[model samples]
Target: MSSNFTNTYTIHMLCANKYEDILTQFSSPIEIEDLWLAALTEWCHSPTAQCNLGTNVPPNSRIACTDPWYSKLRWITLGYHYQWSERVYNESKVGEFPSLLYGTTVNIINFLKHLIEGREISSNNSSRLLEQCQNYTPEASIVNYYRTKTTMGFHSDDAEVDKEAPLVSISFGPTALFLLETSEAIKHEFDAPLHGSFDHVLPIYLHHGDVVIMAGKSRLARHAVPLIFFDDDTEVVSKGALRVSHNVCDKIVKEDHNEGVCIHCQECLTYIRTTRINMNIRQVMPVHR
Candidate 1:
């Protein structure tokens, strides 16, 4: 977990045992987590299903699934839905955070504490690190889907009130080139000439099952995803790995169809092949100490 960047740790292949399970939960047609996706036909009738697209569609408009909305899908919020325009989380537009995701985040935080304790650090430092790990709460998440050519620009996640809590980022699918820079370093670079070099930005390669934790001093660091490697060997989903309930499968296919037929799983695998999914989880509120 050692990293060149202070307070930034990288755990390679962190979710080896449960990677497939995590992917199935998100990629399967049966949505396990309550995702607030824009223009999703199933949620069109709900009051919280306001579309984020810059289209002329009414607030409660019911757009057909046949439209090319899926291709336009980029990101979706979970639990506390973030208002992108305002860069804030609305308390009223909140939902239950996924149990599986919450458990995984807690485990990672505990593991981080264990790693710190094993180091030859002072007792005071070790105690402070343990306290930070124990105080984290997974309150919200943003699931971002990236195509091969897609890229995220440099930005700092400063909307969350709980700055001390670490921001855990989990990656799936092909590897990506992630650039990270400290807030102070970014400010100094901005003062330089227009064509000045950016030598302080650290490039991190995030692969499938990799986890990045931004905590302590690096909590508000500016970061971006400049590129994603199109690796054919990247395992998106295994055959028969997705466990769809019988009732849910029935809704996907005809009642008289073959017993083992599952079109949903096939479509899910195909979509994941060319897409990279990143689950960025964080605490939106201060911990009541």
Candidate 2:
């Protein structure tokens, strides 16, 4: 924790409009048929999912999604009840030893408490990119997703958390294609490029180590996940194109009064033990009234 986020890059971005400085304050934008400018290809997987999932095909694979299974903001079935993640659904909480590999890479919960109450909280530094999320209300339990050729569909991050505040997303795995649109672009039209003059549609190659922050006016802006590509037009450049990341959230599931008591029988008890990893960082604010 201390080592991972000992630096103030995340808090700096939160307080400062550094992200806006990148796209707006910068000069002309350049496009290419053989280069990835937005994709930051850096190696920062502590215990790497590849090492965990064994680079398998079906049951061994995993999807690090940020939205629930039913949120259809961008006309996609994101935040809904779906039987995804074998390890998660099977009540298998692997990775017991808390190495600098997984678990809330960059924690915003401590940072917010530090800001508001001048308190210092400890965290882990597993090279997980910090995505600081803030809001004017409470948040639901977070969720995860991995958008490849299949699995999850096009959707928005606003489904799990409150729709008022913006979502701070960070890319952590292989490079994948992402499409972000607006309400006007996908209000009622067909799936033809999500038409609209105000379309912020982007086929972002969310490569490893890259952090794409969507906030402010673009927070509620409708977005979607399109697809990913392996090779470009010609020669093969690099070989890191599997986009995997988690949105750290402030949502925590408080157990019922049952606490240590078992509510269901042994069969049901064996089921609801393990939970899905919906690591999303949410900005929670107290009620004014």
Candidate 3:
């Protein structure tokens, strides 16, 4: 199994060694492995369901959107009903989500603030002056979704994010394959060679306890889930498990109101997007005149 995951084949496991050194410390797969994110899974799954995260499509919408950036990403469009978005985004966001899950986004966002901080940050009322960004143009949150059996088109991380920002994410429920294709050339050079190799098509086997770190050129590198299979692996599936992950990125944008979420959004509610949680964790800088 170790050899199958070497640099020669799929993604170079930057965290494999990190994971190996500590994976066994726990009794079972626990979110705590990823520390902050682990706690989040428990927090999100809890009854409170306070959420700053959500999938763009319907809970059962079989639609899959392709990456406007790549074609291999098309392969990930399986089980996905369609592969596009038609709504225009606007200025107001963070107040309404899922419409089905309205009022919950705020709780989730506040929770994120608390997560980033070392200490606790209670809601507005109990603020011990722990922290406050009290007023800031909310970074337009552009969210898409991946459903069970749905594939994410292959392409580099989103373009909305400016260069030099880390993509923080959160995952919840249902296991899926996350593929990161990094060939020898692409690994080090953008124009070195357009070699099509599965070397980077790494399926991030996520299940509850998983965190994806996207930064540097690696952040610019291509990634996606070409396909989703139940019991995709007899070994892992027979045990009855699924992968879920979500996170925040360090990117900010003004809701165009003219160009709504391109992948998944309110007008596209009937999308039937899966129930996976994705968030952004990045430092936002105000635009300079």
> Could you tell me every candidate's TM-score relative to the true structure?
0.66, 0.34, 0.38
Per-residue accuracy of model 3 over 175-245 as CA lDDT, tens digit each = 55666654442242234444356434444565433344443345456667565443333332212121211
Candidate 3, residue 117: the lDDT equals: 63
**Least well predicted 10-residue stretch by lDDT in candidate 2:** 241-250
Alpha carbon lDDT at 160, candidate 1: 86
Better of 1 and 3 by lDDT: 1
Q: Given candidate 3, what's the lDDT at residue 228? A: 47
Candidate 1 residues 1-289, lDDT tens each? 2222222324632211111111112122222111212213233333433334433233433333233554566765667888898999888978666666787788777777766678532233456556767878898888787865889999999998777677888775567888776333333324444323365465567755557777665667778998987664332222211222122233445553434445553453345445667888999988883
- Against the true structure, candidate 1 reaches a TM-score of 0.66
Residues 233-289, model 2: lDDT tens digits:
111111111111110111212352222322222222221111111123333222232
Q: In lDDT terms, which candidate is top?
A: 1
Every candidate's lDDT: 0.56, 0.27, 0.32
Q: Which portions of model 3 miss their true places by more than 4 Å? A: 1-145, 183-195, 229-289
Q: Higher TM-score: candidate 2 or 3?
A: 3
Q: Whole-model lDDT for model 3 versus the true structure?
A: 0.32
Among these predicted structures, which one has the highest TM-score? 1
* Model 2 spans > 4 angstroms off: 1-148, 159-161, 183-200, 230-280, 283-289
Candidate 1 minimal-lDDT segment of 10 residues: 15-24
